[model samples]
Target chain A: MSISLPKAFNEFDEARQKGFIDVKELKEKGKNIVGTYCVFTPWEIILAADAIPISLCAMSDEPIPEAEKHLPRNLCPLIKSSYGFAITDTCPYFYFSDLIVGETTCDGKKKMYEYMNDIKPVHVMQLPQTTIGDDSYNLWRNEMVVLKERIEKEFNVEITDENLKQAIKARNEERRMLKKFYELGTLCPPPITGLEILKVLYGATFKTDKNEQNQTIDNMIKSVMEEYNNGVRKVSEDAPRILITGCPTGGATEKVIQIIEENGGAVVCFENCTGVKGNDTLVNEDIDPIDALTDKYLNVACSCISPNDNRIELLDRLVDEYKVDGVVDIVLQACHTYNVETYRIKKFLNENKNIPYMSIETDYSKSDIGQLQTRISAFIEML
Target chain B: MSISLPKAFNEFDEARQKGFIDVKELKEKGKNIVGTYCVFTPWEIILAADAIPISLCAMSDEPIPEAEKHLPRNLCPLIKSSYGFAITDTCPYFYFSDLIVGETTCDGKKKMYEYMNDIKPVHVMQLPQTTIGDDSYNLWRNEMVVLKERIEKEFNVEITDENLKQAIKARNEERRMLKKFYELGTLCPPPITGLEILKVLYGATFKTDKNEQNQTIDNMIKSVMEEYNNGVRKVSEDAPRILITGCPTGGATEKVIQIIEENGGAVVCFENCTGVKGNDTLVNEDIDPIDALTDKYLNVACSCISPNDNRIELLDRLVDEYKVDGVVDIVLQACHTYNVETYRIKKFLNENKNIPYMSIETDYSKSDIGQLQTRISAFIEML
Candidate 1:
């Protein structure tokens, strides 16, 4: 039985449809808008500074032609699209932001920030690539302090420790709610579709009110659990449950999910950058707010980090938790970190996990949609 | 006037010609042989344990075919060639090594090391991508300690703090001599060729005795200084002086340097991984030897590091000091970090430094030799 998405998801769709309306309204109320590209950006600090944080990582294939003029065509499509939106004046979020935050996540995006500076005021956070070292924590903690100071100076607002504590509480609540939302995917014949869940998760990045998002997620979880208890399934019980991992697939680029679902594969969980992995861990509430934020953000493992054992561990845990039948590793073309890592991920899954794996290397174009569909269909058939 | 290389350089060449003979002799004498890939590997710790540290980064076009069997054909040729040497049993250095050390400098090499463990005992050091972080220092320091212990255990010897300090002293002496050797290249008409300097630097990686290497460099510096006093010129005084920087170009890969020289561009300095920059800084003896080694190794400025400002600073200083008219940034194909970084390097040189810059992306094969020569010729003519 195919179950319908809860009404709360419709509310999220409406908010996304009215693009940048909330941000524009907030801007009119004199709120500082901070644009960020990665989840590594500390959203709690922006909230503490009484500034609005919006993810500026674009998901459109349209603006790529414009970005190709500035960047090489062989770069990750996500970067190209995001940059394309910036240069073409297509992303309202980019235009509305008072300041844009960038981090040294990867070489392409790191240097791309220099070009981004030409378009907008950019604050770069020098991120350490290894998490095991003491220097990484200290440096990131100092960076968080610097970010706090910069945000305060830029917005002319003092972000006191008390304010940071309150922000941490609010953000941790969101994380808790998100965790509940994803846990519902663990149910057999998962009541909610991956695309529906992805929409809600991606929409949260730009959602203005944390409390409202928490309420919506709470309602959706309740409704999904109710449906699951009623034995209502959005996907067939026998459908191949796949765990999608590698590279962030956000915005309208849900073609991978759409193709998989249409071809008898139910995406039970996404292990990508923009997935639940981004917010699965909570900030230590007992520690200094800055250190808490530093520890939490540093733990979000990206392929950019050396010996990213955390990412692998998370993937392994999710596979077992979600009852995944197969793994679909989708990497955006030219994303060297993820592309090269596919070899190891495939080997690990096949050898240790005893799970079937398929790798799909694609770009932000519909040209490969047919090919992707065929490959994913074949994979699901095997499952 | 045409100038021949000094007699000391010839002697250094003779030492290299007897390839792995010293290592074999040392092995017979019960000396432990350790292999490393990047400069970030703590040679001091290995030296402290009385092991012969040899750089096993290959620079051949031959073994790539063998490596392609294990790795993808489109991966970094440097990694493929290195791994190829291992699988094919062509590199005597790799065969002779009791332990081969690999660092997480790039995704290609990090994953490749896992496969390399099948051929030889591989020890992977998880290198932090950003040096500015406290975590990077702590992790690297811990890694150094671990390496020291591993070497000590492997060799059945104790690596005390005193041994580390003495090793640091000898390594610093080598650094001091290398500094003097490169300073000769800054002369208006450099007496020593770039190829000649690169040979000496590369040869030092496998040279068993630090004192012997230091003595050789000292004699070479004296000979070069004597040539400068006699007004000897290796290339035309009007030749466009160029600085080459990017990935490590070791082994037999002198195509880039040869192309530059043959195209009327005199390469005066290299800001690459295998160049003087890797050893330009000395460990601070005042601090704990481990911390000092940590600080020095963390400062190598590999492209793997995030927020690589040190690399830019090094390039800027070298451009001005070397009196370089042009900069050639050559990256092995699929080496993503340096490839993406070329844009920023180009922009910085053209806008800030007012120097002509050209980026060449090629592989180990000689197929691109003609194209490289044409481009270098054009760049030199423009200069």
Candidate 2:
């Protein structure tokens, strides 16, 4: 069955344009907007400091050529695109950001942050390469405090414990809603289209009003459940269910999702930064916010971490939850962590889950669309 | 003046074969051998544990195809080469090693270590990504101590403070001699060829006895000084003096040195791990051995560290001391840290020192040798 996206949520198509005006209006009203490139940044701290935290990671090829003028062409397209957008003044999020928070996640981003400092004020959190030691947590917690302090000083406001607690609660609530929104994929016929899930999830990041966004998610969930209850079988029950895992995907790499769908597969879940990797865990509200934030952020199973066991655990859960018949790992070109990690992930899924898996390395360019269509078609056929 | 390598110093060329035999003999005596892949490894601990620490990093392309069977092709050639050696059991150093120590310095090597652990007993040291924070140093010191404990447990021997102090003193003595030997390049018409210097340095790493290697370095230094005093000039006075920088180079990358000499340039110094980056700092005898080791190793000025200011400082001093007219930064393919940092290095050299700089990114494959020759020839000609 061919499922078309519902008409109401098409507003996500205009979210980017609307978000631009929202940020401009916020700036005009003397609001501080913080830009982040990785999920490692604890935006709750920024929120408590009375600042708006928005993602600045780019997912397009438009600005990559400008980034390659300084960066190597073989670099991950996401990194190049983000940099290109910053350098070319094309990203509204980057332009409106009063401060940019970065982390020492990988060699590429860590070194790139140095160059980025020349463009804007960049505060880098020294992230440890492994998450298995006491020193790692201690150092990470201290870095979180340092970031909070940096924001405090930047905004000339105090981020009291109460403010932090409130911010944590609100963010945690948003995570639950988003998690619930995406879990609609667990439905056998999958009430929603993969494109709709991605569009709404992406559009949510641009939202400044938390409770309003939460209500929006609440309304969408009810509508999707209602539609499914009223015999709206958007996706066929037998479509090969795929769980997309690896590097972040959205703007350009959305081609992967489109390819999977076009070739008789439903992208039941995203196990990457743009999805569950960013949404799976919530901050511990009872504990100290800094320590809670440290623990939560570090728990993200990024390939940047050595022996990234967390990624395997998450993939294991998502595979079963989504009833995935095949696992499709999407890696950005030159992303060493994810690329090298494909071996272990492939082994784990095959041995433990007994599910067929395929991994594809791609950049943001459209040149590989035909090849991808062919490869994904074969993969779906096997399923 | 065209000078040749002295007959006695030619023994350095045979060092690899001799070192292989030495490792076998040592193994026959039931001695433990600890292999390392980076300069950050605290080898003094291995020495204190009554074990041998030899560098296991591969600098040849012979095993890369075998490694590419499992690892990514677009990775640091050094990483692929090293893994190829380990998996194929082609490297004598790896074969002889009872245990291997690795560091989380870059993404490629860090992830590769996971696969290597499946083959041999590999212990990865979590190296912090930045050198600026107290947490970074604190975490590093803890990691150093952990390494000491791991070595102690592995060898079933006590690495006491006294034993560590003795090992530190011996290593420090060897470092001073090596420093003095390489300083010979400060001479206008360097008495020793770059090839001879590289041979001796690489060979000395395999020596079991520090005093013996120190004596060899001392003997080589005295011979060079004696030859220089007798008016021997191995290089022309007007040959463009070049400083080699960036990734570790030797074995496969010897082609770069050969090309430089074949062209109208003489490499006066190497600022990379194979040269000064590995040999530059001495452990402070006054501090605790573990603390001293951590401090010295952290100060290596590797591109893996963010805002690697130590590199610029070291480059400034070396450029002035070696009277370098140009810098040739040799980057191994897909080594993101060194490759991306090339921008900062080039800017610093051009703006601060008014020196010409060129960078070449090559893999372990000899396919690029002709291209390297052309680019380097043009660079040297301009210089």
The most accurate candidate by DockQ is: 2
DockQ of each: 0.27, 0.86
- Candidate 1 off by > 4 Å: A1-17, A65-72, A87-89, A114-128, A131-146, A149-165, A217-234, A282-295, B1-17, B62-74, B84-90, B100-162, B179-184, B187-189, B214-234, B279-295
Place model 2 in a CAPRI quality band: high
Steric collisions counted per model: 11, 0
Docking quality of model 1: it rates as acceptable
Segments of candidate 2 deviating more than 4 angstroms = A1-5, B1-6
* Chain A TM-scores of all predicted models: 0.96, 0.98
Put down candidate 2 lDDT per residue, A1-383, tens digits, no spaces.
22233554776656777889999999999999999999999989999998999988888899999998888888999889999999999998899999999999988888888888999999999887888978888888899999989999999999999999999999999999999999999889799878778888877777788798887778888888877888988899999888989999888988999999988899889898888998899999999888899999988899999889999999888898889899999999999999999989999999999999999999998999999999999999998
Instruction: Assess the local accuracy of residue A248 in candidate 2 as a C-alpha lDDT between 0 and 100.
Output: 90
Worst 10 residues of 2 chain B by lDDT: B1-10
Model 2 lDDT per residue over B1-383, tens place = 22233654566666777789989999999999999998999888888898999998898899999998889899999999999999999889899999999999999999999999999999999898888868778888999889888888888898899999988988889888888988888889888778777777776776776787776677767767777898978889999999999999888888999899899798889898888987889888898888899899888889998889999999999999999999999989999999999989999999999999999998777899889989999999999
